[model samples]
Target: MSTAAERTTSPQPMNPDEEAFLRALGRVMTLLPRAIDADMMRDRQMPLSEYTALMNLSEAPGRQMRMNELATACMLSLSGMTRVVTRLESRGLAERVKCDEDARGLNAVLTDAGLARLREAWPAHLASVRRHVMDHLEGADLAAFTAVLNRFPL
Candidate 1:
């Protein structure tokens, strides 16, 4: 294995095929989020981020998670996650609670309203996933696809 210094200082140049592949990957990454967001906004009146927050909370124990943990799960900063939760709270979809184990920590809990919103949004979200991604993979091995995607660094 190459040392960190060697890896950083002697980085390999991308060949033409690799360059093409990277470009395609970049496009998909860029476009997919926008497409998902648009679908959610149009059909459910919720942003993708809000839907993501609700989904994460719904799957968590007690339908709640610490703000920082939820932030990490949503790929957002703690402050950003706080804002998202605040919005949900305003909508009566979620609420913040004091963490029993840690005074300094707060948890975001999904409300019944939040669960109902999630139920309503599920169809649109699933449709977006199928239309934009899964539907294209006819006969493709998903395990292989997942494995290959996981090999790349974030």
Candidate 2:
């Protein structure tokens, strides 16, 4: 087995092919989010972040979860989630609840209205997801594609 030094010093220079691959990967990463954003714009007038927050709430236990936890789940800061939750609350999609179990904590609960919005949005969103991702692969390749995504770092 090669030592770490040998591996690090291996005369291999990541040349044009590796460079091009990295660039292509970066481009795909940049573009896919924009495409999803466009889909959200057309379907429900929801921004991607808001829609994502709603989806996180939808998947949570009892369609409700603590604000701090929801923020982390959606990769947003607490303040950011608070702002988004305010917007959602104004639209009747979500509401802030006094955590009865903890006087100092708060939770976000998706309302029936939120479920309606999710129901309205699901067909278009699922179609977009399939169009952009799932529909491109064959049987085995589909499994492999998901496996790769599952292993990706957060």
Candidate 3:
């Protein structure tokens, strides 16, 4: 087996194009969610995180997911997902139920209200996504871009 040092080769300096791409990726990572969230909030809709949670729940099998799985799917920490689910519960949009197979675990289930809210928010969300992202990618190879994105660890 190779020693740790042998396995740890120095990374090459980024080329100018690579540097520019990295900078742009960083900016997008920072700005995209804020832009989408602002658009949603400005329109008197739920924030992007809540919308995302609802959307994920709406698409899950039986419109429910285990809390931890939901958190992973929503790119949130478990505690963060709990907070979002709590906000949703207060609004009658979602509820937490004891997991059927695992009594110790919980699941987040979307209510009819949540589905309705998601439907209401969909148009504005789509517009925001288009304005902030898709429009900029006009004529770009989306399949290739998606493939490149899939290379990253979730």
Candidate 4:
């Protein structure tokens, strides 16, 4: 039922500047996962998922996290966390234990070797984080970005 003039009365199309901003954000998103995977593999001798799980454990108060919490933080499944913990256990980096609060729950605790490895890998990871994401932004830009990201739909 709409004609050309009616369509013209609708809201304006996206401005070119807005389009360019979208394109740049797309490129940034595309670079992140690949770059993280590459850098973690090269410098840490670990895959991204494993590295993320270890990082979460390292940052925990006691270098331990419930497997369910780890799964949620790492955006993985419980079964997937089991496999990752199994791999870390095989390498003497971490182990699973009965949760003190919940008899049926499990916790992944980082071993001494795992903590050492996290320390060793921290510099490279921090450098990459700085170079790729933080180095380019000023405080205002970062704040604005944080606000915008907060507004996004989960």
Candidate 5:
């Protein structure tokens, strides 16, 4: 077995190429969301997080999903999703309803207004996505990249 000191030691330095790759990944992770959110806000639409929550709800069966499930789908914490849903509710885009299968559980249901809002926002969102991300992938092996990304643990 390894000694305690050895186990607690810092990991070896990454090679130059590995370091460069990590740096680039970090930059993308930090910048991508801000860039997209900026574009959405510039167009007077909701921020990316809210937009994402709406999109996920729209895709759910019956246009409704349990709050916790919606949070997971949106890759947000329950509290974060609650805040987003609250904002959505204020805008008449979504509403919380008791889950039919489980009365104690609450579901976020997309309303007609919500669908309309999503439809209105779709064009701007599409344009932003293209400009910030898809356009850059032109002529690249997207399938390969997708395969690699799919390997990541959720």
Candidate 6:
């Protein structure tokens, strides 16, 4: 067990520019997802995660991927991926198939209906993305921004 003094450490103070940058990053992180998710739900009748899952599966070979791979690609927990898959299945948009190479594994497959739904939502999704993000990036120094972003370990 440690006392308060032992458990506490002073944080290095950030300069004003650093502080402003961090605050702006925080606001963007918070607002971006909410805006995208709200637009998707309102227009697509599905949340962003489900759309992401569909999009990922649509791009995969055979329009299918192992559950673990799908989960990783979607940046979702296994259970969260499972729930999203279940919801898609209920909507006849996706199905789970037993992996041919690994009986213990399952694959998520995009159905024709899923593709159609994706097509239906594509316009709105693209428009929303353009409005919220791509528009802001237009004619900007993307190479520099990309390089800076790539410097981060994430």
Q: Rate the local accuracy (lDDT) of all candidates.
A: 0.96, 0.87, 0.95, 0.86, 0.91, 0.93
Cα miss at 45, model 6 (Å)? Answer: 1.3
Q: What's the true lDDT of residue 124 in model 4?
A: 74
Residues 1-154 of candidate 5 have per-residue lDDT tens digits of 6677876795557899999999998998899889989998889468998889889988998999999999999888999999999999998999999989979999999999999898888888999889988999999999999999899998
Off by over 4 Å in 1: 1-5
Estimate, for each residue in 111-134, the C-alpha lDDT of model 6 and write its tens digit.
999999998988879988989999
- For model 4, residues 1-154, the per-residue Cα lDDT tens digits are 6788988898557799999999998998888867877887898787777878889999998999999999998878999989988999999989999999989998999999988877787777887777777777846577777898999875
> Highest lDDT, which number?
1
Q: Candidate 6, residue 9: CA error in Å? A: 10
Clashing pairs in 4: none
How many backbone clashes does every candidate have? 0, 0, 0, 0, 0, 0
Model 1 per-residue lDDT tens digits across residues 1-154:
8899998999988999999999999999999989999999999899999999999999999999999999999999999999999999999999999999988899999999999999999999999999999988999999999999899887
Q: By TM-score, who's the top model here?
A: 3
For all predictions, the C-alpha RMSD in Å is 1.7, 2.8, 2.6, 5.4, 3.2, 5.0
Q: Report the lDDT tens digits of candidate 2 across residue range 5-31.
A: 998899566799998988987987888
Q: Report the C-alpha displacement of residue 136, candidate 5, in angstroms.
A: 1.3
Which stretch of 10 consecutive residues in model 3 shows the poorest summed lDDT?
3-12
Which pairs of residues collide in candidate 1?
none
Give the residue spans of candidate 6 off by over 4 A. 1-12
In model 3, state the lDDT of residue 26: 98
Clash pairs for candidate 3: none
The positional error of residue 65 in candidate 6, measured at the CA in angstroms, is 1.2
Task: Flag the better candidate by TM-score, 1 or 4.
Answer: 1
